[model samples]
Target: MTMIAVCALWGMLFSVLLAEPVQAADLIRALMFQEAQRVLITSGRGLVRQFPDGAEQVMTTPVVVTQLDGGMTLNGARAASDMVKVRGRDDDLIITVAETPVSDQPQDRLSDKVSDAAGSAVPPAELGPPPMGALRGPAPLHTLVLAGAVQVIRRGKSLMVINEVDLEEYVKGVVPSEMSSGWHLEALKAQAVAARTYALYQRMMNAGRDYDVVAGVQDQVYRGRRGVDERVQQAVEATRGVVLMHQNAPVFAAFSSTAAGPTEDAINVWSKDLPYLKGVECPFDANSPYYRWRAELSLQDLENNLRRQGIAVGTIASVTPFSFSRAGRVGRLRILHSEGELILRGTDFRRVVGYTAVRSTQFEVQSVGRTIVLAGRGSGHAVGLCQWGAKELAELGYSFAVILTYYFPGTEFNNTRFGAQAPSSTP
Candidate 1:
């Protein structure tokens, strides 16, 4: 049969999963409005509060928000003058300079009335990052581009600026950051669903915490309304509330750039062997740039890595692969030294040897004098969906649902429940 016929066949395997249906379009507002559907994204340093008039605020007396040499840091005033950093006793956010409060609240002064009647709801057109793209001056002077509103709070001594936004809106920002918008629509849809699921999982995990998820690599990259493509927005809306589930719980839905040969089991990377995260072949990923790679590290550099991992043995002697995972990745390895030997899991070794340099756990180690060579396949922990593989599949005429099931087997799809507050377990 043709690829389209095969896609249709695969699609038939998944019918509506729930007897009581829930619309994907309204899933966020219906199930998670109580939870606020707000993802707490960590704002980077030097986040200028850009107003409708183009005014910027980088600091507030005691609150010194600077790049700090291109790092995320917000401490007391720097050496701009004679201001000293003061540590407050209580754990609330305070914009204070030395001892006095320095409040720089955003000004909301609109000449026109927001509504025809007081206490009436603001129309849908009026809801967005306040006057960001709105024309300000007489000359149609400057169009202000910005992320959504930022909520600044203190996490201990430092101020944490969070971008609190609706969960579906948050997915639109993530799809572009995680996958290129120029790729196939199905692949973008897969990314959207995965990101949405991951966000909900994080929400459930951090429900009572200060933030649900961060806007960094640690969670998912989110830049509010900035850089999001229209195609990306369409993909997010298409998937809507759909999420991967295993035993009625929202699967962690881990994903990576490429899986050179086959995806890995969760136990290999995170040490958690969930039901849905089993090894699966991904032959299409050979089209990825990271399909095959090699890294050469000096023996001394390897020794430095050992020391950084708190292992001391002077110099290295030999390296050996102790064990392998089911997906053909190194599960355990031995580092022989002149004094003794150190045992390490493949993921831990990759961390110590430099994640970028080592690239992946699937590699062969060979020593050529003072240099140690590592030849590997793939980039990132090959756990769930292989993005490049998905793109290739989509290009080959597979639907998003078919693509998702190909990567993650045994998970059913339905707009109902949509994986929010997923039942503790489902078969």
Candidate 2:
């Protein structure tokens, strides 16, 4: 009798474990149009203002605006005549609506417009950091739904209209051409999606700018490889089965290969090229930003460390930062720079043995007579749907969610209440 009950329980558990993921349709409904941190609307052909809070104030005068370092500012004007000053410690702005709208598309399309507007909706606003204490000036607040196209300035006081068609061209021709294809856009989208305030958007944009430079160069190198087709897709698919140890609970997923170059080479050289680096030894001879990274790893090293913790070794997959946190925290590693050698110290491997630490993704490789340090770049186990990589792919023709599906296998794409659903808990 006891044996039969145990067997029955096992069957029930097994069945529960096999439940399906959430369906696509359900995920769609669950997905909502997230609000934006700030917005600029063209109120009419010759008038414009910005709304920082979505649907809050009906209208305002002068315009509320804030300044950010690195050539960014937040505008908070609801009308051409008046503006309100938002006082906050953070430097970014959160705009809800604009006084004038140049296009009929939804607010999400603004990036497209800014990226490609054919002509100035209004002459660009005269952009300069607002004089300090300008926030104390009196401004009016009102409410009105703006309809139709209006011109505006980038940093000028005059209102103007911008060509929507030109904006489309900008998105297709200018913006896409200016940035890296996959990873940079992905980071932009992630920031846009996550932004709750204008300051956040500035942060995202700044990060995107940095990410673009690196990704742009790397993409060229990846495509230069001989005999590789669908290079971006292959890179996206490369991260899998590799474990990224972090201070937080481990985040697991495969990363796209296109984003794997930096970290993979770093680890390869550290593990295979020269003897393990002790404190702060410059590992690579290559003259580039990546030349500074000092850590290396392999399946054997990872497995050995896991064994010490009584953890079983999972399948060996691509190692990339996508397996780690969204922000890519490698445990608690800190980057140290001095005396021509880079040093990385943190709780990244305090619990593990035989793993020397370094900061850059470059590594040394020495396997099967290949005495080259496969200096890995980037941080995390490369795998499924790098958010930044996905953006570039999306611009190239992949859908936002499809990019997610392509990177994460065995995971279905859906638009249901859960975007992707888990099997029902109840029998």
lDDT top scorer:
1
Q: What is the C-alpha lDDT of each candidate?
A: 0.57, 0.26
lDDT of 1 at 85: 25
Return the lDDT, model 2, position 418: 22
Candidate 1 similarity to native, TM-score: 0.66
TM-score of 2: 0.24
Write model 2 residue lDDT over 379-398, tens digit each, in one string.
22222223334444544554
Q: Point out the worst 10-residue segment of candidate 1 by lDDT.
A: 104-113
* Residue-level lDDT tens digits of model 1 in 288-330: 7667889998878888877877878667888879999998899
Which ten contiguous residues of candidate 2 have the minimum total lDDT? 27-36
